[model samples]
Target: MLHGGSLPHLTPEETLAPILSALESVLGSARPVALHQPHFAGREWDYVKDCLDTGWVSSVGAYVTRLETALQDYTGVAHALAVVNGTAALHVCCLLAGVIAGDEVLLPTLTFVATANAVSYCGATPHLVDVSPVTLGVDAIRLAAYLEDIAELRGDTCYNRTTGHPLRALIVMHTFGHPAELDALAELCRRYRIVLIEDAAEALGSFYRDQHVGQWGLLSAVSFNGNKIVTTGGGGAVLTNDAALAQRARHLTTTAKQPHPWAFVHDQVAYNYRLPNLNAALGCAQLEQLPDFVSRKRALAQRYQHAFAAVAAGHIVNEPQDTRSNYWLNVLQLHPAYGHLRDALLETCQARGILVRPAWELMHRLPMYRDCPRMDMSTAEHLERHLVCLPSSVDTGSVDTGSEHA
Candidate 1:
């Protein structure tokens, strides 16, 4: 629908013209291109069928253990616990990081709401921070400066000068599978005496400086949602290098049941967040093909970069230096001068079945988090206005619409 036809009731601005043309060139004019979709070209059917045939579709099964082991190996984390969803994994991470009531957790304002919600679940305040334009994640330098000004380091704990709440942890979310500046952020956290946690929900195949993204944090969360590069039909995983933390995560996520074969012995109150065998069966198959999926996704991102190279209004957001990204969802960041055209572009693209979308609203802007402690949000606000996510499914057939670049 967005191929060569003119948009009705539109001013036909030069900026919008090239963007639409690029979308048409990459995604064709026949059908809608979803922003992100799961591709199950691996052994999903075989593994899932095996689970079905064996009647091990519940939480306790061989597939669940296999999936966890595979994740541990893939991410290079000593422990990987498969959970019900990404949010659940984050919640567990927050708990493990010792985020208690009245504590404050540093979070990127540009991330999804789930990151903030997870902290809230731990009874901690989500102290919002700004993100870097280069990585679209927490700006380590800016945050360091902000912390130097407002953070009080007494003993080994970091406290907010204004709120007087202990800064328990810093959650760095890898936006669109692009790894954040983990080394710098880790150094900053160490100086401030704050824990480092990673919201790696979108960074399954991403690596920072040859090291996987989740390895830098004390604990990290990864998602396998339907729209993610890897999907477990709504599942997630918690990764940690500490064996003690891993053991606690396993017990907590499994309802804290002490090992007893014949008796229903229960320990402390915990959650039933274990991943079902049905979901892990799918996850195992998906994990096996992660390398292929990341390759195809990177290829798709290259295509988008080439298609939009000549567009003066914006350019595709590339992976940061020294990082290998999965390019989970390719981003088109409009130039500051062309920021006003973002809405028009989104509306036009969606109307024409291109399925483009803007980034999520900043966490500080949301009503529930309006009163949360926050620093200057100028960077995130600008990014929110200029960012647009393009269709980035791994299936290249849907995007190979011919070389009709604008």
Candidate 2:
């Protein structure tokens, strides 16, 4: 018996066997291997079939409305606007937040590229700040320092000299389904008159205090991509408590047209960013299952944590405890003191057929973001080399047990 030891990291053979078994049992031996299979059943199928049958499979339909309604209920936000994807949702939020060209949007560098890309879409500069190693989210003290430095250098209350622009907004990304420092970020935004937009793409069921992730910001976004916890295959939504901002986002996403019968008059430039009814139907079904999915994912995470507790000493990583997370992707950060051993461990996991992946290269270090203003991301750089994402799925099936090192 392994006793307090974590279970062995998965081998490719081990990972494939269960998926193959499920497929053989459900779809027969004809199906090929798949990394992920949608777990839709019950009302999900009903929704998909009904959508096809009604010929309301395109962008506009009752299903879209239902998705919006369900999202509002699930997140407790006053309004929700479904969009084609998370990027579109963030773009629309930046537009509504008045993030114009030459303005700077403060954001953490340790997030998906899209989080920073959306700022570029509006022609605004992204000021990528370093993150706290503990939370893997933006550092509040560092942010304040950046703001103060800019204010002093520019002799302006709002503009930063390094970026050569006024910091117009703050885009807070909830990294890996864990809620960021929202309460502190919110207060900072308010004090600076900076618009706050939460990138809750990875944090659907995650919460800060008692409120859900999407409900914290003035404008917030969520993604339902194929790899996400609750996927609509490809869809996203923006949530807001401000009635006017919600109305404006909806208007802009649907082509910014004035209501005219057959007039086809467009008032301003807009985007073809509305979610298709078919996708929305899928979203609605997924939303219905989110609670169950969250519960199962958390349970799986607890198992991983228990396993890791044994091996995580000088070189293993573990989860944070300040806030509850949706556990979208279970991460293990190798101790930096492990040095070259981090790469060796990653190679070992892969050699054993486990699909462990490194943290995204710090966005500021990426070729596209190199020119963007960035504070020295010492912590992000340290974590980047060692953090690994395990093959986490709510449908772990018989492979429910796994080892993790803290």
Candidate 3:
């Protein structure tokens, strides 16, 4: 409701108190509430029990295969390989993308650290880019222009002439479950011959123009971490439509074992990043309840939107145009004038037993990535100052049927 303009604000306490009270009522407790947590309203126990009863709790089991099938079906991607975590999936994507030492992986600066860390794990430097104020994802227009101004086309590959490093791929994060401008970004990648990898870590059920977020890029990674829309405790998946890329991902993640009945033979130096069967069992159950979780989270987002309509200081972050978000983490970006109140609001909420968190510091600001090349990060700086992650756990089985039942 506080759209595109500043509002006349009272004191910070006066402004945030009502919002906290509203949250307390919705959450059904004055006790501390987590930002996000796993919800097991379906057959999670039964699936895990099956793994336990069959004694197939490790990497090898029916559950792992079933989980992959569920992901492939839900996401409409041809191939899905379950891995240990989202970071593992990203690292594998880097390897498969042909990113080598001294290569530069372009990504948005306003995302979680895992995206940059994954690029670092591949021995490539991260090239942080600006994000759109509205979408909170990379800005395609700016990215294309930046590439043109600083990059060169050396035959088939694009290289950042400024840094003298080949630009291997563009890693776009679907920030907070809202699908980015995939069509524009994909076209840019094509023009520059840059491989595209979608870090749909928070966007398991999100879509852009009816196409799932993870299905558009050359390869994508989805996280099943506890905070994501769907949780496998500690699991993730790599998704791609290309059979060759999918097969390569599977082989590389499973330690490149040359299939032999009992031979200890490995064809290449690979990572043991396979998701454990126990986690996959949990993932299978979570996938079954994903639709319901998505629905309930959207309902909560609607409630927050309506509430924010009455409050002038906060604007509820919603799905961007032509996109359907899972609303994984409900967000509010305070007006810049009131951005100074961010710390006060966070502390106030946490003291009142509601856990609210600010966005991560820009990757370029970090010491490890300080030297990485980047374009203007002004928009990301604005976001880092204003945005806040609110409580958005699945409310399927909440005890309090109050406003949270929205």
Predicted structure with the largest TM-score when compared to the true one:
3
lDDT of each: 0.90, 0.75, 0.87
Badly placed stretches (over 4 Å) of model 1 are 1-12, 396-406
lDDT of 2 by residue, 1-406 (tens): 2123454555544533432232233222321222233556437778988989989998789989999998888889999999999999999999998899988888898999989999999999898888877678887777777676764333324667654578888888878787878778787777777778999998889877877887767899999888788777898999999999998998999898788777888889898899999998888888898898889778767766655543432222334465778888777665344444555655655554555567787888888889888788888888787677665566643332221111
Candidate 1 lands at a TM-score of: 0.95
Q: Give per-residue lDDT, candidate 1, residue 298.
A: 94
1-406, model 3: which lDDT tens digit per residue?
Answer: 4545656657777877766655655667645577887777678889999988989999888889999999988889999999999999998888898998899999999888999999998889999999998789999999989988998999999988987789999999999999999999999999999999999999999989998888778999999998888888899999999999988998898889988899989999998999999999989988999998899999988878876766667678989999999999889888677788899989988887778899988888999988789999999998899998888888622664332111
What is the TM-score of each predicted model, taking all chains together? 0.95, 0.86, 0.96
Per-residue lDDT of candidate 1, residues 228-248 (tens digit): 888999999999999999999
Task: Itemize residue pairs with steric clashes in candidate 2.
Answer: 12-353, 308-404, 312-406, 316-406
Worst 10 residues of 2 by lDDT: 397-406
Q: Deviation in angstroms for 127 in model 1? A: 0.5
After TM-score superposition, the amount by which residue 255's alpha carbon in candidate 1 deviates from its true location, in angstroms, is 0.6
Per-residue error (Å), model 2, residue 136: 0.9
